[model samples]
Target: MIKSIGQLFFLALSCLAIAILQFSFISSFPGAFNQINIGLIAMVFILFFFGIKSAILFIFFFGSFMDIFSFQFFSFHLLVLATVSLVVYLILENWLTNKSLYSFWVLCLIASVTYGFISSILLFVFSGLGGGFSIFSLYFWQSLLYQSLWLLLVASLFFNIFVSLAKRFKPFFLEKKGVI
Candidate 1:
């Protein structure tokens, strides 16, 4: 039980770290490109290895953290994060193969894109009341494109680090392979 709590605490800390970056650093990218959302990417990282409970905690805290920084958005981010996290977890947890560089690449790309669209959609609905948002605006496309680049670059660089850490702890969800 203590081991599990330790893991959860580390996971939460990681989520908070990414949330801080996503809020202050990534959003300062000087254009719509910042919408790639490193926080959500880190949340995806949580989903990749952690079980449903940890992923859910990470998502809730992540969205809440973002909300704290955001103005007038209330729980919109939280709702979207939870929904997307669940869907992503369901698909990836079942279909994903054991750790591989290729899976990391594809999963990162997919998670980034999924986050982009889901958050955009949520924003669109909320902003539609004020008639100020456009789902197809050029900014949307630019963000999606640029964010994918960021996702690929970051995931490539960090893939080994996450894998190595997972190897050390062997989190609850990762299946233990048999030794020959």
Candidate 2:
């Protein structure tokens, strides 16, 4: 239990670093990278390695931190992330192997698209409540394309890195028995 707690501590530090990169450095750029959701990417990466418990731990805290800093409401980011996590869980659980890069790429794409669409629609709804904002336009498509390309790039580069790191985390779900 002590070791598990230590590992989670290290994971939280890593999540903090990712969040710093996401909120601080990424915000400096208003280009394609802004369209890329580093939080979502890290959520995918963390989920792949840590199982739902630790993944949710990181995501909830991370999203809360982001929410506290940004204009979004409480649980908005969490809701989007939870939705993405569920989608990933369902798709990966049934149709394909988790180790497949094909699956990783496709899932990353699905996650990026889902994050963009769902968040945009929610933002629209909320903003509409506040103002007369209407969604669905060229900007949305461009943002989606930018985000999709960015996810493809980030996933290709980081999937192996995160998977290898996940080996260290040794997901808490599987039994510890080894076959000889």
Candidate 3:
């Protein structure tokens, strides 16, 4: 129990740091670079490796941190993240049973697309209803495209490196001896 708590604590800190870096540093980049959505990528990674329980906690911290920095209404970031997480979790639990790099990649792709679309839809709706800005423009689509590409690239690189080092993710194979 203590070990689990420690792990959760560590995850929270790391997630918080990721949120800060995402808003403070990554968001400052020009054009498509700023649309990378490292926070969403990190959340997908957590969901893939740490299971839904840890991922729920991660979403809470990371989403809350992001909401703090966002210009939209409170909890907007959290809502988008939670929605994406739920969709990924359902897909992972129901369809994708294999816990391999391929599945992780698929989840990352799904999460990225889902996050972009959901956030855009919400922004559009909110702007229609009240004070938010419109998102139905070329920049939105371009950002989504760039975000998906960046997510897949980063996820593939990280998954490969981590899989190489983590024995748990390595595939098991049987060696055949002489005819028995």
Candidate 4:
């Protein structure tokens, strides 16, 4: 139990670090930039290694943290992240084999699209009314493309790290019997 708690603590800190970096980078950018969110990377990591429940819990807490910092109302970020996690859970439960990179790429794409569309739409509906792109436009497409590309890049790096770590910590970290 103590070991499990320690692992969770580490995971939560990792999630927080990802969130902080992502938010800070985006905030630093001048123009409207839609970079791949490290939060998503953390989510995928948690899901693949820890389990679906841990992924959901991390997302919930991470989203809440974002809500507290950002202008968006409380729970808005949570709702979007929760939705993405639910979709990932369903997809993983139904199909996902041998930690396939191909599948991970596809899943990242799906998650990026789902999160981007939902969050953008929600922002538009609530706050973007003041000044925002049309539902269909070049800017919107560009942003989506940027986000997807970012997700791909981040997913590639994260997957590599995960695979390497699993190899190194096979018995304690990656083995089914050793997993908590």
Candidate 5:
């Protein structure tokens, strides 16, 4: 039970780290061409390796953290994050390929598109359509495109690190086998 709690704590810490980095990166840059956000990558990876319920919980916790940090209209970000996490969990577990990099890419693609769409819609709705907040107004499509690429890159990198750490911990498994 302690081991599981430790793992969960680490996972939550990792999620918070990613969220902070993503938020900071976006705020610091604000560049037009470099708008890729990897928040979903962290959530998706957690879902794929752990479980759906865990993913949902992680998203909720992380989203709530975001709500605390956000200056205005906090729930929108939380809603989008939680919604995307749930959708990715369902699609990854039910529809897409699994246990392979190809599946990971597919998940990333779907996640990117869905998140982009939701983000665009939320922006329009929240901004009162900007008096014209169409998808084109905030460069919604372009943001999605770049964000997808960001997800791919960040996911690949983080996945590698995660796998490496898991491998390093393999000895702990053998330690229970009377081999050590």
Candidate 6:
């Protein structure tokens, strides 16, 4: 029990650090660099390797952290992240059953797209209340496209490194023997 608690603490700490870097450092960058969603990428990584429970925990930590820093409505980040997590979990459970690099890449793509779509919808709804931002503009689509591409690039790199260092993702080969 203590070990699990320690793990959760570590997870939360790491999520907090990622959120800080994402919101403070990454978001400060200009153009496409700022469009990269590190939180979503981290959540997808946790989901693929650590399972849904850990991923949910990560989403909670990361989302809450983002929510605290964001200027939007209360729980905005948390809501969008939870929605994305649910959609990704459903996709992994039903359609993408394999835990391979390809599946991870695909999941990253799907998750980014889902995240962008859901967040835009929420932003649009919220904007009706006060804000003046438009979700259907060309800039929004461009930003989403950049975010998805960056996620795919980062996911591929991380997958390759993890597969090399860990046995979990090692491919199994069948050996054929000649009959004597």
Q: Which has the greatest TM-score?
A: 6
Whole-structure CA lDDT of model 3: 0.85
Q: Which stretches of candidate 2 lie over 4 Å from their true place?
A: 128-135, 162-180
Report backbone clashes per prediction: 0, 0, 0, 0, 1, 0
Q: Which ten residues in a row have the lowest lDDT in candidate 1?
A: 166-175
Q: What is the lDDT for 17 in model 3?
A: 93
lDDT tens per residue, model 6, 17-87: 99999989998999889998889998999888988998889988989989999898878999998999898
For model 2, give the 10-residue run with minimal summed lDDT. 165-174
Each model's C-alpha lDDT?
0.73, 0.75, 0.85, 0.76, 0.73, 0.88
Scored by lDDT, the top model is 6
Q: In model 3, how many backbone clashes occur?
A: 0
Model 2 lDDT per residue over 1-180, tens place: 999999878877777777777778888887666777788877776666556776688887787777766777677787888888888777767776645567778878888888877787777777756753334577777888898888878887886676576565234565657853
Query: Which whole-number lDDT from 0 to 100 does residue 85 have in model 3?
Result: 94
Between prediction 3 and prediction 6, the one with superior lDDT is 6
Q: How many times do residue backbones clash in model 1?
A: 0
- The C-alpha TM-scores of every prediction are 0.77, 0.80, 0.89, 0.79, 0.77, 0.94
Residue 120 alpha-carbon offset, candidate 5, angstroms: 1.6
Task: Please give, for residues 1-180, the per-residue lDDT of candidate 5 as tens digits.
Answer: 999999778867876876687667666776643576656776787777777878787787677766677774778767887778778778876887545666777788888888878876887788765655556655666677788888888777876777688763222323556565
In TM-score terms, candidate 5 sits at 0.77
lDDT of 3 by residue, 1-180 (tens): 999989878977998899989989998899888888888887888788878887789888888878888888788888999999999999999999798878987898899889988887887777776744435577777887899899999999888887888767888878788855
Cα displacement (Å) at residue 150, model 1? 0.9
Q: Specify the poorest-scoring 10-residue window by lDDT in model 6.
A: 127-136
Q: Comparing 3 and 5 by lDDT, which wins?
A: 3
